[model samples]
Target: MNDPSGPDRPPAARPRVRSDLDGLPLFRGRAAQSGMIRLDCNESPLAPPAAVQAALTGAVQGLNRYPDNAAADLTARLAERHGVPPAALSLGPGSVGLCAQLIQIACAAGDEVLIPWRSFEVYPSLAGTAGAVVRRVPLTAGHALDLPAMAAAITDRTRLVFVCSPNNPTGTSVSRADVERFLAAVPPDVLVVLDEAYAEFTGRQADPLDGFALVREQLRQGRTNVVALRTFSKAYGLAGLRIGYCLSAPPVAELLGRVAVPYAVGTLAQRAAAAALECEPEVRERCRHLVEERERVRAALLDSGWDVPVSGANFLWLPAGPAAEPLAAHCREQRILVKAFVGEGVRVTVGTAAENDAFLAAASRFARTEAAAPVRSAALG
Candidate 1:
């Protein structure tokens, strides 16, 4: 009975601004296509050792019972491994969740969190969703972190700074000296989160920044402003379990736990993670294998005169640029799924020995095509 031209109803209220999402595909799932080599995500190519399997079987006995809410025992073992007190650690579903939680606790609308461009895709997205302004800095010319520029980017509004050592996608790392300089430059008020998810593969015996040691020193200085985020997912080969831990001051640890979902570190996850921790020898050996393969893959690419960057993570970063899409397409056509950077190039994870061989074949073919193109003429002319 009412007029058809009557004023339209107002739209329903929605979240005004999602943290750094800015229309980015933060949760895009991988496509399920046949012949997929599956090197998209940075997961360990190896499976958890047999001891871990047995431990998981034991936990199945308690499937009906709830997990240890405190995660105290696991946290204790983690603390001992790092030589810190149990009160200084907190576990999470994974290191990624802890990153999200840290932002939620410290960041508010208009506040800024500093991160790197061409690094972990999650940082900006998480910061944006947590209501913080994301300040994205470009990596240095060599693909390493631009610590100086990052320090310069910090302002009074900056609350958190995330440094992904052996950065994702690019596989470059900031040196210990650079990190020390960066820390010295940033204001003491800003909290620094050193994400060491791939640290185990770096092969640096006295780990740069020695995040564990740094956390302890920072806390002793009455600084509640530093944290080292590590995971059992990568080196421990338990990515499916999704267990990670943080080393920070107790107050900060407690704050993170408060913001964390109750029982997020699941029963199975905790037990499996604990079991994995006990097998340092096996875990270390696997990491050593990955490091070895990373070199083998890099050598083959370099011998072909491919302009591959020096990478330390369980992946390699290639220079695709204009050919990026086409190169990725070529690999995809052959049923190999690698992580493609629309803005940069392709990131190929160092998969199992067999998978690496397949990727190398694809890459070599692409390189030959590139070599035969007008690119040579343009460069010479």
Candidate 2:
């Protein structure tokens, strides 16, 4: 008899995966390499406040039990804090996870998800994973989202639109008035997701868009298609814990909850976020310092002849054009890391003053070297 388990037997057919996913671009946030001054990911340079740390310590004792799938206590606390009913909130691993769920609930196959080009990299990936067509509207010449262009691009099949305030990698935002005007032009059936991952850093910016306030206004107006995503990752120093909440109409929030990964928000994350809310003064102070640093860094880059845009976030975008990768490599040589978008630009987070100073030093040196190369080439010619 033939040996059924022998090497001669045909290899078991590989499990099938969605072939469309093969075309999806891998998400690419660099991890902190050893001994590098990491400013690549837009994570808070400071750790969580003492109260939050204590909460995490206490929460560790209950790891044997599954987290509350509904995150009831945390939801109630967040509802009270935001002055929204608990029914209007949905918890997820991060705002990014909520983003995926938003795409899931809104899009069927071939439906469209509109986003600003180069806004958040994950938007396309999430939409594509849900079998939706990704539509990108380009940013304006000044690197801000072109809200009018995005509004014009929407078709009836457009199920969701992501408006990332203080857009990732660019550090530019849409003003409240501009967003309101754009919303007026949007079809009432299309969902608008205001991604406010860096909202705390925008307090000092002139005429900043308050996403939570906008969501509340939409709800009061009986529009159920607008949603706001907030995270504890940035200003609250809970990036590792991965807790975020969505503010939406009660029906939308319920839909998000229905599709969310059960218990994705852990016990420690919930407790830590609750403790973080109690330490609002400390979080505010930290954000204040980061904003100041962000402005200072932008000024320094401008003074050094780099055309840095005015940012409402805790990072600066250096539109390095073709030299983006080389500039990033130069910083790495000095043991500093920044997120580079290849031919597009580089995003450097506002870290502690010393860290910023070191990056500034590296950046200055790279600028001088870059400036000299063309001159030398001209002389050679």
Candidate 3:
């Protein structure tokens, strides 16, 4: 008999992958390039506070042991900070990770997740990964979430809805009153996830929605569907640590914890995040400065005749339409990186003063060059 392990032996069949994932777009972070000023990923321009850095250094000694699976200490700190019971909070690697858990807990194959188009790109990917049908509600003419349309789009099949305030790419936020009205239209059984990753930067915006406050009220009223997600990556400068938390009704939080990967939030991240909470004053100051920089950059772009929308987040949206890719290309050529959304627009993160100035100069040059050229159709044909 021929040996089964012989070189000419028949190859074994490859393991099967989920057919639904074939067309799914993978999310990739922009790689850092030496000498390139990156204003593409919406990251904090500053370093983490000294206290947080110190905490990380101290945490390194405990690497031989496993992280606290429950994240007890950090959870308690967050509970006190938000004035909520520890039972109502769940910690994950990041708000994005929490988002995936949220989808897992709420959706099964063929269930629907309602999201605004061009808001957070991850929402669709996460929902799709769970085999959930994604219903994209288009943004309004002003590049903002159309709450009325989204409310109408919900059906009995809808399992979850993601409301991204000061939305990711557009930087347009809905008012608290607007969210309250939208909530009234949504069925209580369907989960509404308030993604507030940039909540710390919304202090300067008019009528900003306090997601935690809203969730607290909902919990008090015995409603358990509304959940608030906050991340330490943006204003807290903990992007590298990958720590975030969510506030929801105790039952929802319990579900999230149950579905979370074992020890998802590592010891270093937990310690760093807890230390970050103690440095709230420093975090607030950094956010204040970034918000100011955001406004200044928007003003400059507006003066250059760019249809820049008012931004409440740490970035600005340039609704360049068909010019989006070319504009991003031009900035890239100047050794500056900005995010371009194919036919939609470009999102430029606010950076240090010098870096912002460099980006501004490149943008001005691109504007002048485009002006000197013949006008192209919006279709780019």
How far off is residue 46 in model 2, in Å?
0.8
In candidate 3 the C-alpha lDDT for residue 347 amounts to 93
* Candidate 3 lDDT by residue in tens digits, 1-381: 778999888998978989999878899976758888889999987889999999999999999999999999999999999999999999999999999999999999999999998898888889999999999999998889999999999999999999999899998899999999999999999999999998888866567799999999989999889999999999999999899899999988899988999998999999999999999998998998888888888888777767787887888998887778888899999999999998778999999999999999988898777531321332133
lDDT scores in order? 0.83, 0.90, 0.90
Report the lDDT tens digits of candidate 2 across residue range 1-381.
658899788888989988888899898666647998988889999989999999899999999999999898989999999999999999999899999999999999999999998888889899999999999999998999999999999998999999999899799999999999999999999999999999999855667799889999899999888999999999999999998989999999989988999889989999999999999999999999999898888888888777788888888998877667888899999999998887788999999999999999999898778533432343245
lDDT of 3 at 176: 96
Q: Model 3 residue 261 lDDT?
A: 96
Q: Candidate 2, which segments miss by more than 4 Å at Cα?
A: 1-9, 371-381
Local lDDT at 206 for model 3: 68
- In candidate 3, list every pair of residues with a backbone clash: none
lDDT of 1 by residue, 1-381 (tens): 645556664555787864345665567757565657888788887778999999999889898988898997898888788888898898988999999998988898889999988788888878878778888999987787888899999999999999998899888877777787788888877889999898888865343556777778878888788899999888898888888889988988889988999899898899898898899998989889998999999999877656677776888887666666777888887778888787577888889999999989988787668532432343234
TM-score of each model, paired residue for residue: 0.91, 0.95, 0.95
TM-score of 2: 0.95
